[model samples]
Target: MSIKLDQVVKVFGTQRVLDDVSLTIAEGEFFVVLGPSGCGKSTLLRLISGLEPLDGGRILINGREVAASGLHLAPEQRGVGVVFQSYALWPHMTVAGNVAFPLETAGRSRSEVTRRTEECLATVELTRFADRKPADLSGGQRQRVALARCLAQGASTILMDEPLANLDPHLRGAMEEELSAFHKASAATTLFITHDQREAMALADRIAILWDGRLLQADAPEVIYRRPRNRHVAGFIGQGSIVTVRVTAAEAGTAHVRLGKAGQDVACVADTQPGTAALLLRPEDIEACGDEGAQLCGRVERSVYRGGFHEADVAVEGLDAPLMVRLAGRPAAGERIGLRLRSGWLLPA
Candidate 1:
């Protein structure tokens, strides 16, 4: 199912939780809405699910208007299933019973419900645990049960609200794989909501960054990370340093910019013109080099081991903030190092 939101608005008290948010999610696409806490991510989901009414604009599902002036479809009427962070499984029911609940409620025959429940359980590889109660399953297993129940609903679209937030680091990694497999097996259009950028990057066909009741940027994960539309989107999507640079020359999609008293060329949008502009230098863009061919030099102010590599803050002479770089080995504080500008993005003026 495809979802289209045109100038959707939702308010609470004096606050406009969602302000004129608009986007189109194609059918069978894994679309993710990412934002920080208290950023109306949940409210946006509720409005789409018909749990909350829109104050303005319209929402359509597969070309049919589900929400607009004076019209609101109930959750069940939307043909979308939801998997919440809590899993929301019935405590007293076994795995099979939970998966069978929706089918039974909709008046399917007993034999049909039983057969469908078994199919869903096998899809999630939980047929062995079909007789186990919710309390007897692990966190990941419980989450799978919720997914199986959603599958039983035969929903064309699925809405997930931070469904992996409650899992431990190790379990979260495992569930991510499972979720990807589940989506393929179900072939459902998924609208997943989460604050974790890492998770968003991993699972999304496209990602929408929602901040302060508005949609900032919506694009593929690589585009959002590499060429953010604005400073806010650049800062929010990944770790990087935004430094002021002088674009000495620019043509095509490359810009020759001066950074901290050194000149180097980097990638930029084609519209970029020669002048002063903000440059986004990711950790991978700055590399340690020998003094013979260094583009910039800095002092390592701090270094910390980040598992396989060390992340260091390099304080250049004229830049306001230190540039972060990944090092193969930890460097001593105040040590001088030569760096090469491998690549960077010039923010739109």
Candidate 2:
């Protein structure tokens, strides 16, 4: 089912937690809502699940309004399964019992419930541990049990709220792959909430970025990463440098922007009128050079080797902040180096 939100707003007393956010999730797509803590990501999920009431606007499922004008469908009638940050498996029930409990409650026959439980166990590769209790299972296995239970309950859509946050690094990676495989196999519309950019980039077909309780931008992963709409979007999505500069000239294909206090002209590719702008230079786009080559003069303050590459903290003149440049080789302190700024995005200052 395609989920749609139209000018959705949630208020707590006088505080507006979600501010007129609207978005749509395509059927069978891995849709991710990404933002930091207290950004209303979880609140949005709760509203979708019917766990909370919407203060304003409408929510539609399959083109039918589910929440509008203070009317909402109950959580049980939503046909949506929610996986919490902590796996919500019953401690007293065995793995199979946990999976079977939901089906049994839905008025299914004993044989049907048993069959479905076994199927779910096999899907999550937890068939052998069907007789084990929740405390006996590993953290990852317990999570799979929660997913299996959701499946057994016949959920057509799933809402996962930072589902992998509690696992170790290795287990988290494994679960990511497993979740991707499951989504492909099940073909269920998924809404995954996370603050980690790598997780969102790795899993989402399209990402909806939220900040300050508003929907900032919703686009494909690569487009949002490459062409951020504003400084907030660029800074929130990934690592980059936003340097303020003045527009010396403007044209269709290119513009000349002055950088630093001395006003060094840097060529910029722009599609609109150029004025005061901020240039987003990624670390990978900057190359280190000697006194020769097209170089911006800077003095290296410190250097650190990060596995495959070296990062140098260089103090550039006329700029308010120091420039972080990734180099092919390590350049030590007191070393004079030059930076070659290659490709970057220019935003209005």
Off by over 4 Å in 2: 251-254, 261-270
Encode model 2's per-residue lDDT on 72-148: one tens digit a residue.
Answer: 99988888889999888899999999999989999999999999999988988899999999999888888889888
RMSD of each: 0.9, 2.2
**lDDT by residue for model 1 over 85-188, one digit each (tens)?**
99999999999999999999999999999999999999999999999999999999999999999889988888999999999998888888999999899899
lDDT of each: 0.93, 0.85
Model 2 steric clash total: 1
RMSD of 1: 0.9
User: Candidate 1 at residue 328, lDDT?
Assistant: 96
Candidate 1 off by > 4 Å: none
Question: Candidate 1's error at 10, in angstroms?
Answer: 0.6
Q: Candidate 2 overall Cα lDDT vs. reference?
A: 0.85
